[model samples]
Target: MSWEESYHGRLRAMAGDEEVLIMVGARCLLRDDQGRLLLIRRSDNGLWACPAGGLELGDSIRECAVREAWEETGLTPTELAPIAILSGADTVGTNQWGHTYQFHITVFLATAWTGELVTETDETTDAGWFHPDQLPSPRTANVEKSLALLAEYDRTGVFVAP
Candidate 1:
């Protein structure tokens, strides 16, 4: 078998009998009134992704999302109705070694939050609001999924995948 297949098989074995191979993490899609989404530049990897991070011990996913938003962009996110609950195997993620990988992600679409737009922390080297139609160059793959969830919210006043 190929290296990736073998690795996946091992992971599957490691997760034996469990439905999901990983725990839940948190993410937030913070949008401005103009339909612009806030994105962060990670200091570690320097990739532009939505202001998000993994959950800490004893922290709820929503709390993790809000905290990550603040830590990265210096913006306080107000939790709105949940936008989506995405579940799958092989959900890709990145490692500290710059290796490509996968994880299950729980994404949220928050409508209420407060904070001026400013760079405040090293967790994110830069922060900016980008129009959905004019997303920054080299956007991450998951941005499209977030945007699709937002669009679904706009169309149905709820987050139901089409």
Candidate 2:
């Protein structure tokens, strides 16, 4: 079953012409002192992924990441440390809408966290902290990339390069 059959959501971004490209989204890398990152089991596909979602209208990309993180994990990130800017063809949700050209995503390393992680949200079912090496069992491709980016940031503290 494709993402389209799994999720009834839409992805639209201001690219070119009048058509809104429905492929852009954001992902957040929240890590703790133990080097564990936050992950949410998506309610729609049961796949583990970083606390992330699509960018809505009238929302800055940074704000969108923060909002999606909070909504999905029920935790507030205090700071946003730039990690890596990922650009590539991405299939938003469960839809196979002919992967769009490089969905510009700004990955971040959030060290400070507040509130409690809850599973009472509609978007996410389960939430937990896992070591980078011991990530979840069923994580999305983007989740894997996000984890790699986090490790890269940890090693160099530089987000631009690999």
Q: Candidate 1 — which pairs collide?
A: 93-101
TM-scores for every candidate against the unseen true structure: 0.76, 0.77
**Model 2 TM-score?**
0.77
Q: Estimate, for each residue in 6-94, the C-alpha lDDT of model 2 and write its tens digit.
A: 22133332233334344445678888888788888988778888887666667787787788889888888888776887764443233
Estimate the TM-score for candidate 1.
Answer: 0.76
| Error of model 2, residue 40, in angstroms | 0.6
Q: Candidate 2: deviation at residue 97, Å?
A: 8.1
Note the Cα lDDT for every prediction shown. Answer: 0.70, 0.71
Give each prediction's root-mean-square deviation over alpha carbons: 7.2, 5.3
Clash counts for the predictions, in order? 1, 6
